[model samples]
Target: MFSGKLFLMFVATAMAQKDLSVDCGDDEWVTVRWRPELGFSQELDSSRALLGNCPPSRPASEDSLFFRVFLRDCGFIQQVTAGRVSYSNTLIYDPQPERAFISQPVQCVYDLSVGEEEPEETFSMEIMNPDFSGPAQSLRFRLGSSIPIRAVVEPRSRRPLRIYLESCEFATDANISRAAQVHPIIANAGCLMGSKAGNSSFLPRRRPDEMRLYLEAVWFAVGEQVFLHCVLEACAVQSLPVVRKACQFVPEHHRWVLLDDPSQSYACTCCDSSCLRTTDASVDGVSARKVLGPLVIVAEDPQGDASLDSQSSAGLSEAPVWLLVFAVVLVLMVCMSVLAVSYYLCFWRGGRLGYRPSRDLLTKY
Candidate 1:
C-alpha cells in the first residue's frame, strides 16, 4: 500500500495533430532514492537544489569539475523512473488530472559555474544507443572505423540560461585532465534557446531546447569507456533556497536525476580477429543472447586440448617457424635440380663426363 502524488498535463505542439495526452506512467518520474532515513531528505535536497551546484568556474575552462549525471539508454531510465513514479511524487500536488495532458520531458540542467561560488562536480555518465539491454550496453565498432557519439541536453532553468558543453571521454588531447577541455567538442554558450524544439533549425541541435553532440572516436578507443559532461555556466539555482524565517510559496518544478556511476558506462572492446559470438544459452533472460560491454570471447582449443587462449597465442608465435622450415626445404630442392641440369649438359652431353646409374645399384660409395 504505497501512495503518493499524480500530476498529468496535456502537451500540444506544432507537430501534434490536435492535442496529445501523454500517459505518464505511474511508475515513471525522476528522483534520487538509495537509503531508508535519508532517502526522503535526499530527494528533497535534489529537488530543492536542482541547479544549485553549478560551480562558478569558467564554462569551458580546465578549472571546472564535470558533474556526474549517469544517463543510460532512454528505455532503461524510463523503465526505472516509471516504476518509481507512483512511489513518492507528491511534494506540491497538481489540481488538474482530468484536463488534457501535455508531453512531459524530464527536466534537464547543466552545472555551469564561472568563479569560486560553486564547487566543481564530476558529471560522469554513458551515452549508449537505445535498446532492450541488460546491465552492460556497448556498441560494436571496428578498429579503423568510426561511430557517432551524441547527447541530448535539456536545461532545467525557467528562463534561457548560458550553458557550456564540456569534454567527453572521446577527447583526443593527450594531456587532457577533465572531460571539458577538448577543442573539437562543442563548447561555449551561443545556441541559447528557450527549452523548446521550435526555436532552432540546425541539424545537430534540431530540437531547440536539446543539443546533440558529435564526439569523434579514435583507433586507440578500441577498448575504453565513453562519457559526456555538460555544465550550466549560466547560473546556479533559479530559486535559491534560503532560511524561510517567515513564509514561502511552492517553488518551481524540477526533476531530480538519479546520479549514475562512471564505471557503469559502456566498456569498449577491440576485436583483433573475427570471433563467433558464442555464449551459453541454457540460462534464461537477456543474458542468453546479449550482455554488457567488456565482453570476452575465447577461441576454441585445437585437437580438443586443455589450454584455450594460451594455446591459440602459442600457435600464432609458431607460424614463423613453420614458414622457415618450408623455405629451407624449397631451397634444397632448387639446388638439387640445378646440379642435375649442370651434370647433363657439361659431363654427359658435352662428352667430358660419363653417367653411372646401374653401377650405383650394385655397389656402395
Candidate 2:
C-alpha cells in the first residue's frame, strides 16, 4: 500500500510537471509553470543580457532572459446585440513563438439589460513570467474607444528601446468614438499617434460619437515588430448628426475645401484676419479672398522677330534695299560680259587665231 501510494504521488507530480515547462525550440525545452493564483508577473536577470554572448557564470537553468507578453484582443467586443456584449482574450508574445504558451483563452459576456447588476459570468486568466534574468518586458492595453489605444510599460527603462504593439489592423469603419479621449492618453504617454484615417478630422468630431478604438504599439525602432493590444470599445454613430469644422491641419495657403456635407466639414484657417473670409458668391456657402501678387515677367523668344517696330528700326539703321539690288545686278552684268568674250575667242575666230578647221568642213568645200 505504501509503494502504491508513492507511485500515485509520482504520477500526480508528473502530470503537474507536464502543465509547466519552458517550450524551447525542442520538445524537452524547459517550461515554467504557474498556478492560476499567481496572476501576471515577470523577472529578468540583469547580468545575463540577451544582446551578446557575455556568458553568465550561472548554469543553463539559472540563466535569465527578458521577455514580453502580448495579449491579443485582450479587451474586445466580439458581438453586441440588444444590450448583450461578448468578448474574448487573445495571447501574443515577443519571445515565445507559440500563442498557446501564454495562457488558455478566457471569454466574458455582459448583458446590460440586467440593470446595473454584476455580469452573470466573468472569465479571466493570469499572465506570469518565471524567468528573472533578462530585461523588463513591456505591457500595453487600450481603454475606452478612441484610437490608438493607450499603453503602459512597467519599470520604464531610461532611454529604453520603444516597444510597439502590433497585430491589430485598424479599420476605418471600426468604432472611433472612444478614440478622441484615448488620443489624449496616448499623447500624454509620449507615443506618436498612428492613424488609418488619412485626415485627422476623420476622428470623431463629437465627444460622444467616438466609439470604436483599435490599438497597437511599436518600439521606437523605425521598423521593429509591433504588437497589437486590443479593441477597446465599439459603438454605433449612424444616428449622430454630421458636424463640419475646418480641418485644423489644413494649410492657410490652400483655397477653401469643397465639402459635400457641410455638417461634416470644418475649416482650419490661418489666424490672420485677411486670410479667411466667407462670401455669398461662393457655390458653397463659403468663399475666400483671392490673394494677388505682382505679374511675372516672361522672357521673349529670340526667334520671334516679326514686329513692325523691329522691321522699321532695322531699315533705318542699316544699308538700303535698293543698294543690295544694284550690287546683285552689277555682278550679273560682269558675268555675262566674261562669258561673251570667251565664246568669241573659242568659235568666232578659229581660222585667224591659229585654231584648226575640222576635216568635215574641208570636205564640204
Q: Which of the numbered candidates is closest to the native, going by highest lDDT? A: 2
Per-residue C-alpha lDDT of model 2 across residues 2-99, encoded as one tens digit per residue: 00101110111222343233221111112222222122453333332211111122322333333211111113234434554333322222223232
lDDT of 2: 0.27
lDDT (10s digit) by residue, model 1, range 243-292: 00011111132211101211211110111121112212221110000112
The C-alpha lDDT values of all candidates are: 0.26, 0.27
Q: Which candidate is the best by TM-score?
A: 1
Residue 209 of model 2, lDDT score: 18
Runs with alpha carbons beyond 4 Å of true place in candidate 2: 1-73, 78-84, 93-103, 111-192, 195-365
Q: Candidates' TM-scores?
A: 0.25, 0.21
Whole-structure CA lDDT of model 1: 0.26
